[model samples]
Target: MTIDMNTLDKAILNRIQTRFPLTSRPFATIADELGSTEKEVLTRVSRLKDAGIIRRIGGNFVPGKVGFVSTLCAAQVPEEKLDLFARTVNTFPGVTHNYLRENAFNVWFTFISPSMTIIRDNLAAIAEKTGVRRILNLPATHVFKIKAKFDL
Candidate 1:
């Protein structure tokens, strides 16, 4: 069943959609900005998580600008070993996200290398570990920049 959010949930999500304030007490600041208390925001975040509306709360290294090289790689993991292969590949320090896509290459993941050499070496290691002879390393061709928010 799909979960439908009410007004408060909408408000909470809107607060999240905006760039979270950069402050030592971010939750407290969010509470102040949203006309609520820190405990309220924290409780709502927990409720959202429990309701399966929010997956995670974390930050990432500034992509590209931080000398973090990244590329999209796909592998055709044997249907039975898909999970295992994905799990093994995920063990890499540089992998950021992984997915099971509908394309011929079912197991797709985003890998970031400290450098190009590490990227190649990590791919080689993943292939060896997974016994996946066929792999596609599609380096980024073009990045279409877009934003997720709009100003009304």
Candidate 2:
């Protein structure tokens, strides 16, 4: 899916990916910085989102700092049931990230909740719903944070 974006679109993506404005009118603030209008920025952002260039726009927070627990989960889903398994896992609000990998435990995701008990219960529910029983929940002992920004 090749998307043809203009300079303003590129600027918008670059600006928002890292330091999104912490203001009531974030789009307006971005427009002020980029010398564009609030309406134009909003319209461009909407177009980019519709075209799938932008998946979502929101704040990223440290789960632990916010009184939440997170874990890395993997499941050995058969190729035939991969789509269903992924869909089922995604139905849980705690699932922050989900993707497929070319490994024995192919379906992987990050789950965050207020406690490990909730995460465990959700995992059990996911297994019951998907019929993929061999799910592994690996909680992190050490935390590592990295900044990920694209130059686009």
Candidate 3:
């Protein structure tokens, strides 16, 4: 699963992991910083994304400041219904991250919504729909380190 990346690819990955210009033409800005053309930057980024080097490109907002609350949810899904349960959970707009683990509570995800009520309702609906009885709702108790930077 080793992907051979060129200098530009490595530079793009490393640079973007820390700072991406907040501009209308971000790729153009990156191109300027990298001594390359906008087209070249865009094309290389597209190739990187297509090759699965980049999972996503978006903004991260502070939940409380932006009128949002987030929670971590876990469900003990049976092996037979894992696929259906995951697909159903993914339908919610607020469900940002979902994962399958090798544990008693095998399914986990993070969700964000305008209020705790909405978050609870969504979790209840998911539980009822999927016939999953035991769901652990873990809300953030404190703020800690939350950053992902790679020097690739």
Candidate 4:
């Protein structure tokens, strides 16, 4: 779906994509930066979210530094059970992101936990609950670069 965003929306997206304010009222900070009222900024953000332009708004942390373990998991779920499988995976708080792709391993997600044992146990429970035959748990061995910024 395509959204015809206005200049304000574009500005908001560009500004908030990477460096969001870490203040008590972050939206108010954003409003100040954009020369908009806090209510206006909040309303625009709400509209963007309603339009699916914003999938999520949250914090991202370095797993290793924070005493947390993160992994990329994939499962080849049958088409008939894809919805159920995806929903099952979403129940876990550690399952941060889940997606359906066009490959043998059609389901993919990122899971973060305090330890590898917790992640493994959660995956095992997920497999049991979803009745998926196989789930590939791929931990990041090395990262050349990682960036999550989109230019508007």
Candidate 5:
């Protein structure tokens, strides 16, 4: 059965938001924090993943510190042109996540680059290959927190 999102699901997600401990008894630490048994916590996390409520459990990283620049780009593509546009956008290096959002600029993606100039060129190449007349490059001036464990 597909699991519906609920309170226990939220707790499982909350536990994952923080780093998973590295110790001989890490599960005990997590259990203490979540008011759950170690086995229960482990089972619930696995169940959520199986049911597609939790996609992954991991830490987010900083790109510049790791010698790369990361940013989000939202591109405006013509509706009749999704396939052609998606093919071009998907070809760029450093594109990790790409999704279609229902808005003016629908093709939203995150990208990483070795330098800032490469970001400009990458967007340009996408535009050229897709025959886009206008493209918006909004490299993140300030990244924001978009992740939170919802109190389902």
Candidate 6:
């Protein structure tokens, strides 16, 4: 699905991908930078979001630094139950994201919570709900943070 984007739309995307303003009127700031009005910027942003060009707009934090724990979880979900399994997993607020992989452990996701016990309990709940018992939880001993900005 290809979406048509004008120059201002592309500029809005590029600006917000990184260095988003830390102010009360962030869109206004973006508008000023792009030589557009806040209303125009907001309209464009809303259109882009509605078109699914932007999945989400939020901050990414280091779980450990913020008194939270994170782990990488993988599950072997049968093809027939992929939708069910993915939906059940996504219902948990701690699940950041999940994707299908071309491997034995086909469904993989990252989960974050205040403690490992909570994560384990959630994993157990997921297994019971989805009936996919072969779930692996791999906690990271060390974390490597990287910048993930796209040059739109």
**Per-prediction RMSD in angstroms?**
3.3, 1.5, 2.2, 1.6, 4.4, 1.6
RMSD of 5: 4.4
- Candidate 3 per-residue lDDT, tens place, 1-152, comes to 34678999899888777677999999899989999999998888888888878867877777877988888899999999899899999999888869999999999998888988998999899988999888899986664657978787
- For model 1, give the 10-residue run with minimal summed lDDT: 143-152
Candidate 1 segments exceeding 4 Å error: 1-4, 47-52, 58-62, 149-152
lDDT of 6 at 111: 97
What is the Å distance of residue 121 in model 6 from its true position? 0.8
Best-performing candidate as measured by lDDT = 6
* Evaluation by lDDT, superior candidate among 3 and 6: 6
Residues 1-152 of candidate 6: C-alpha lDDT, one tens digit per residue: 46799888888999998877999999999999999999999998888888888877888889999999999999999999999999999999888889999999999999999999999999999999989999999997899888888777
Greater TM-score among 4 and 6 belongs to 4
TM-score of each: 0.75, 0.92, 0.84, 0.91, 0.59, 0.90
Over 17-103, each residue of candidate 5 has an lDDT whose tens digit, in order, gives: 667787787767888887888898788888887887766664567777688888888888889888888777777878776779999
Judged by whole-model lDDT over C-alpha atoms, candidate 6 comes out at 0.92
| lDDT digits (tens) for residues 1-152 of candidate 2 | 56789899999999999878899999999999999999999999999998888978988878999999989999999999998998899899978878899999998999989999999999999999989999999997777989888997
Each prediction's whole-model lDDT (CA): 0.77, 0.92, 0.86, 0.89, 0.77, 0.92
Which candidate model has the greater TM-score, 1 or 6? 6
> 37 in model 6: Cα distance from truth in Å?
2.3
